[model samples]
Target: MTQLITERSTDVIAAEINAIKFQTQSMMLQASSEIGKRLIEAKEQLQHGEWGKWLKDNVEYSQSTANNLMQIHTEYNSNPQAFGNLSYSKAIALLGIDAEERENFVQENNVEEMSTRELQKVIKEKQKLEKEIAKKEADALKEKKLLQQDIQDLKQQLEDAHQQSTDHEDSEKEINRLTQELAVAESKAKKLEESLKAKPIEAATVEVIPESVQKELDQLRSKKNESTDPAEIKFKMRFESLVNEFDLTLHALDGIGNSETKAKYTNAVHKLMDKMRATLEGGMS
Candidate 1:
């Protein structure tokens, strides 16, 4: 008798648990439909500010709770063919996703088999992944904008440098022509001095050349020797060294990943070259 009573008690306990499960499932079904219907009907009443009191007094539910129920019906009730047998919790977790995504998610994950906790976990993971991707896209767009600005600045700098280069070239050309003329004049003066020495002064009254011409020739020779200036030679050497350094730096920049930084350095190099050219021209002058 004692053994039979124990078996009966165990069966009763199991039956009680099953009954609770059936009642809970029934409550969820009604909440999905009935709660959704009541919320929809109360939309106008809500605008009139009556539904808040109604929800508190008559429905005995918070607005957030009702909102979840409405989302369930909106997402799943009308599309039960796609989202079959979803629990209230799983459907709530899927509220933010659209219909097509709901269908795919349900099919892909066998959402019906998932417990509420498992579904919520997957939803959180999905949201996190989406946020990460959005952040990456935003960062890439920002980086692209910075690069474009750098390129624009570089273009403007190049244009300015080109104009400066033209001016420097003109100055260099004119100075080079004058230096060549001074060299030729010096050579001619040396030949004249030698010729004057070779020709004997037959009479003291006979002038070898005009005093003014001789004085001018001597001044030209002195200026020609001074033109081999040490400062000018040093400037040329420094300019050549800087040019080679700039080339090497540009080559190194090609290996670097940061184009914006490289562009800034390149602009600096161009400015330095311009300054060097100006200094050299001033020295020559």
Candidate 2:
């Protein structure tokens, strides 16, 4: 029976100790909140430039400590009941979180049950995660902007290509029309030649042609002389054909995406240009 009594007394003593511990913690939290509140009031009442001096002389506190207390008061004064049992160290550690989120964080993580170090660590990790997520979101937004710009550029290029294709079709149609006109002119010229050959020259008094007709004949003779100039016609035709071929080559080059192949083609064009330049220089000399 004595042994049983001793065991029960031991259990009662342990419960009392736990209760006292709880009460002591609560009192400390209340004291801290009160101190913070008084600090805030004192700071507001003090002169603008006298805060640091007042803190140092009157309260024997550093500027940092005073700032911390004022921040704590601002964050916790309104709802001290929610955090009445928190220790001073834990409250200070929890200050890392925003005031609105602090209560929820404490409830969710059971911060009251955790050590100050653990709470600080958890807050640090949360801050790091938030930073990482913010950075990623910013990067994603930047990439999205860049992608949109690229899309816009591609759209403009496509529109330009469509316009160029329309112009090419028009040029082809013009070339076809000119070719048809040339063929008809050639057929008429052949018939006229045959008629002239079949007609015999009759002796008659010289008849004066109209001034407009003489002028027309003179223009035709001049045009015939120019057309029969072999070197000039050959030079013009060769130059036009070469220019067309070079334009086609450039279009083909634009289609090549491979850097190495494009570089090779570019080098070949450079060499050809150098050779042409040298030939032209020799001819000029």
Candidate 3:
């Protein structure tokens, strides 16, 4: 019982662990998606810079104002109106991107590439892997079920073989006993004929009761009755067939020798014969 409980507990733990891994995997992908969204949103606002050629080409501004705006932009972390408040669109115009090298690094990805076509390809692949894992788990379950079914089938076959052996043994015994009874009865009939022949023509013949004869008569009748009962006869016949079958099985198994099956079936056959004999006597008495 304790072992069974332990096995069940392990199975439950394995199921829980799988669930947690799947959920954690989803969360990790979601985090990656959040990073992609953040990068895209910052793209436009980082286009313009306060000290860029755009400012020199457009309105002439004091170097000090530009310098102050640059400080403000750095301080505000890319806000256009960094001094107080600013719209994201205006901020991006003044600061093109945070760093030219970093922006270039982000642009190296080929938009036409397969990896870039779908935003959620990684998640889809993860799901596909999960499906393959699930299929493997289901296959394991099927294999275990098949093994259990084989065990059950073997158990039932063992029982049947045992019963067959027992019935065969009983029939053999009954046949032996009836043979003895028939021999005795034939001897008595022969004696009776002899006595009739030896008697004198004028002498009166007296029949003699055999000594201790009740038991013998009962044995003879029982044997005849066993032959007449369809069920008993059927059992006897089947038992003979089974014995033949058992011999063949034993030969085949002996070639393979000392296997679990051989020992199991042999024991089953003995048990069945004993059971059958008991049942026969039980029914008679």
Candidate 4:
């Protein structure tokens, strides 16, 4: 008997091996899915307490194994074609990903070519990244809420300051009106005294300004002189606003989680303070 020898190129051999691997993986996936489906049916028919005993006696499968198989069936049974290149181990490992993201993750990562351990590592990393992103988003939302509250408080303070300014202006106007009225009254009194003096009457009753009125006029004049200057009021308002803004900046700095970023901002704030101090000292000089 004579046997024929076959010679194949490396490329042809590699292609053949890959084809075989693909067929083998496809069969494995189908077999596991079928087994899982039957196990699910069996569990449904069994009594509530007999599930473990049935698995042990009938199939020698532990509850954990049965659970994994049922879960695999539930996840893969709907669209097995999409994952036809996945081996049983690969499919099982892929279960770590959510159903919604599994297809896209598999396609993007070429999960069919990855080992089970590699797939698990990638899944863990992805989960960790997602958790970090969610935490950052939550922190950003909280910061936004705090900033909005701070803005609302600042607006209220501005409104109050404006109302006070308006009241001060009204008070100044009232004082000016009273001064004008007092001047008019004094002029009329002086004219009446002059007319009496011209008549030379012996029993002329002269109208005299009351002591209380004189004192009240003096008090009004003092108050007018002591009233806050408009420019001074403006300066005070601006200074208070600057102080509040600086306080808000400090508050914002407290929320910084990165030490390097916080330190940078702290240094900037110190420089700004030094500049302001220098400017103020120069003005005093």
The CA root-mean-square deviation of candidate 4, after full C-alpha superposition on the true structure, stands at 25.8
Q: Is candidate 2 or candidate 4 better by lDDT?
A: 4
Predicted candidate 4 versus true structure: per-residue lDDT over 186-232, tens digit per residue: 34334433433343221111112235643654453344334445554
Q: Which numbered prediction scores highest in TM-score against the true structure? A: 2
Give the C-alpha miss distance for residue 95 in model 1, angstroms: 1.1
Q: Tens digit of lDDT per residue, candidate 2, span 183-273?
A: 3334333433342344321111012123564465445323432343445444443543454345345545655789999889989988998
lDDT of 2: 0.63
TM-score-wise, the better of 1 and 3 is 1
| Model 4 segments more than 4 A misplaced | 1-4, 9-11, 47-49, 155-285
Winner on lDDT between 1 and 3 is 1
**Candidate 2, position 208, lDDT:** 19
- TM per candidate comes to 0.49, 0.54, 0.20, 0.53
Query: Candidate 2 — worst ten consecutive residues by lDDT sum?
Result: 200-209
- Taking all chains together, the TM-score of candidate 3 against the true structure is 0.20
- Using lDDT, rank the candidates from best to worst: 4, 2, 1, 3
CA-lDDT, candidates in order: 0.59, 0.63, 0.43, 0.67
Residue by residue across 1-285, what tens digits does model 3's lDDT show?
Answer: 355543458889999996775465444434333433443344335465633453456435454444444433343443212112222222223233344332332235221222332414533454566566566445435534543553354345444544554557665555543443344334433433343344321101111122334344334334543454545545443443443344344434444456687778778867986998899999999
The Cα error of candidate 3 at residue 10, in Å, is 58
